[model samples]
Target: MLKLLNQLLGLFCCFLMTACSSVPKLESNAIAPIVKLPNNHEELGVMSAYSDPWEGFNRRMYYFNAKADEYVILPVVAGYQKITPDVVERSVHNFFSNLDEISTFINSLLQLKLFVAGETLARFTLNSTLGLAGLFDVATQIGLAEQNEDFGQTLGYWGVDAGPYLVLPLLGPSSLRDATALAFDNLVFQQAINELGLDTDEELLISLIDGVDARASLPFRYYASGSAFEYEHLKLLYKKYREIQVAR
Candidate 1:
């Protein structure tokens, strides 16, 4: 059990070094196909109004995460993608995304987004039932678009300061609030699956599947950002993205 937990932790740290929030909000005027921290957000994401005091530590962790992704994480994801049929892959993606709405639903209420909480409930209901347990994304087709919410965003909504940038050992870039939120969310999530009848092993396996699916969906590659300044660029983008998420 300890070995499996360690392996899963390593996989998560390596595979997902990006995005506290889901992929950035879509924009009609956005130029980037991936839509992370839209260039237009010069007020914050272009550069930080605040400073990264721990940039030295962040840079080392960034390098470590990049190498891990290249050598361990991406290779595994590639193999999984190669073997899985596209339809099956899509189904796996949707199923996990649907399950994530449970967190979104709770976080929406925390953030006091009553309309969004309601929307999340409706989306979860429609997807789980009409969408075949979220394997088909029927909710999206019907217009109850999935909204990503998390405790980090909840704190932000409540006017909690981000309180300096910090990169977690396996979690990559995050503020103090987001990092703490991550830990709390994991605890809540574990209890949730426990109630749903997942044994520890089954829960770990499911988490693995979800992580892989999310990594597979991203358009970016580790250390392949095509610029020597990629790290700086990512910092700016992450800041901008999170700011938008908070203020939006």
Candidate 2:
């Protein structure tokens, strides 16, 4: 139950940050700070550079995750979309995003990011009260931007190696260090929910709702990259994204 909940929790948080952002223009100018890579960059087998010591198991998990997405997650999200109005959906997104700041705040302190920690705390406080328990994100308009921190980033900041690449079934790309961090965070979250005197079924239902809300908000479709080797392409991207995030 915790494993499934964790997967949905990650999904909900992932879309919360990006859903309000504008889409990037496909065209790029020469003076752009970031270089635009062609979609077909993987045609050159650039994914070969990614080292996956546990490729055998990771591949199997990736396959399992893909099947779960198609047969289970997508159908539920479709029904959720049919029932939920846009405004209500956005409110759910905002509420979860605000709750996520709790995790970010703790991780920010763990990494000793004083400024970020303060900002996260301030965002949580302001949004929780003034924003109507996080159903609205008035803080963003006032400039307390979200600082997307997690224990994985915290561990990375402390010089912990990623250990090994992993593709958890339904959880997607993660490293050994990140996986451990995720488990720790989930345990804390579960304990907190238990302290509220909720039964196991109620907790699981909350997790399901969170996952469905998040999955409904997502814009991406599984294996929609059109790459025959989509798995490797995503694996490489996940690795590089983590490296850059840790560097920040």
Candidate 3:
């Protein structure tokens, strides 16, 4: 009887521990205070004011994207609601690899790294050809690992300090130096776009469609989180991750 009682007690304790572990903790909605600009108060003030419209635009865009993401993820969650973390992690890794290849290709062309550019071009072409136009993973098979360098990293490479944090409309988080770098990058991209001429509209349209499709692909992962707060937490995590990448 004592042995049976002891077994019962152990089972009860295990139940209590499992229940405790399943309880969700309440999280506070506190964000770190943004850093300020030095010796550029007036300029920052103007930029801040200008940024207001963009913030609204970005908020709307974010909302739309969130809604679209929810729609895309619904079917996935319905079928794979209990998918393992390792599987989800692999999907994230694959997504980043695809993005990195695109970034590397653009950067190599702009930076005039002929060898790197050639490699990127070859990788991109092969991926598009065999990977079903970059919707698959052909680059990984050929040993061409993805590489990513944003405008912020480009600026950092040139010894630019990341000035005060500035949240721009539609574009999201950025620093002063990064904003300048973005403008320069956009200018270069525009030159390339212009060089392609009127006949390239179909290609441009296809590229834009591909971008939208890619953005829509991750909605299910966000939806599985169960709340807006959880989604925002994930976003902040991504922001911090990107900032670390820039700093490096």
Candidate of highest lDDT: 2
Error of 3 at 82 (Å): 24
Task: Tell me which residue pairs clash in candidate 1.
Answer: none
Q: Which regions of candidate 2 fall more than 4 Å away from where they truly are?
A: 1-46, 191-197
Q: Where is model 3 poorest over a 10-residue stretch in terms of lDDT? A: 1-10
CA-lDDT, candidates in order: 0.73, 0.75, 0.48
lDDT of 2 by residue, 1-248 (tens): 22223333444434333322222455665455386666655454445556799999998898887789899998999988889898988898888777778788888899889999999999989998999988999899898888877888889999999888888777788889988899867765666556558888998987788778766766556666555565665666577767887898
TM-score result, candidate 1: 0.78
> What is the per-residue lDDT of model 3 for residues 111-215, given as tens digits with 9 covering 90 to 100?
555676677777767765776545566776779755555566666655667664444433334556666777655554455445446467765763443344333
Q: Any residue pairs clashing in model 3, and if so which?
A: 54-169, 128-133
Could you give candidate 1's per-residue lDDT for residues 1-248 as a string of tens digits? 11112223433344345433323465888675664565546445434455789989998998887787788878889999999999999999888777778888899888889999999999989988888878889888878877877788899999998887876664566788887888767776676667669877988898888777777776456556445556665565566567787888
RMSD of each: 11.3, 9.7, 15.5
